[model samples]
Target: MVLERFDAIVFDWDGTLLDSTAAIAGAIRGAAADLGLPDPGPERAAQV
Candidate 1:
C-alpha cells in the first residue's frame, strides 16, 4: 500500500459538511430536560 498527500484541505463550518446540528441540538435539549430544566427549543438549541 502507498500513502498520498494533498496540497490543500478545506473545512466547512456550516451544517452542510457534517449536518449533525439537529442531533447535537436534540442531545442538548434532552440533557436539559433530563436535568429538569426547560427545553431551550430548536432555535435556541442551535445557537448553543
Candidate 2:
C-alpha cells in the first residue's frame, strides 16, 4: 500500500503541542494534597 499526505494538519492547544503534563500533574497533586489525598505525580497526567 502507499501513503498519503495532507496539505496541512491542525491541532488543539493545552495538550496537542504542549507538554503541560508537569503543570497538570502539579495542579492535581496540589489539589490532592489540599484534600488530604496522595499525589499521583506528573506521570499520571501523561497517561490521561
Candidate 3:
C-alpha cells in the first residue's frame, strides 16, 4: 500500500472568519421582535 501526504488542510467554523456576526444577530433579534417576542440581545443571538 502507498500513502499520500497533503501540504495543508484547512478548517472553518460558521461565521468564524466573516463579518456577518452583527447582521445575523440583528436579524434574529428583529425576527423575534416582529413576532412580539422578547429580544434575545446581541450576546444571546450570537450564541444561537
Best by lDDT: 1
Cα RMSDs, all models? 4.2, 7.7, 5.7
* For model 1, the run of ten residues with the poorest summed lDDT: 12-21
Looking at candidate 3, the ten consecutive residues that score lowest on lDDT are 11-20
Per-residue CA lDDT of candidate 3, range 1-48, in tens?
Answer: 899999998867555776678888999999999999999899999876
Question: Model 3, which residues run further than 4 Å from truth?
Answer: 1-17
Q: lDDT by residue for model 2 over 15-43, one digit each (tens)?
A: 67786777777788888899998777778
Predicted structure 3, TM vs. truth: 0.60
Number of clashing residue pairs, candidate 3: 0
The prediction achieving the highest TM-score against the true structure is: 1
Clashes of each: 0, 0, 0
Q: Across residues 1-48, which tens digit of lDDT does each residue of candidate 1 receive?
A: 999999999898567677888898999999999999999999999887
All candidates: TM-score = 0.63, 0.53, 0.60
Candidate 3 lDDT at 32 equals: 98
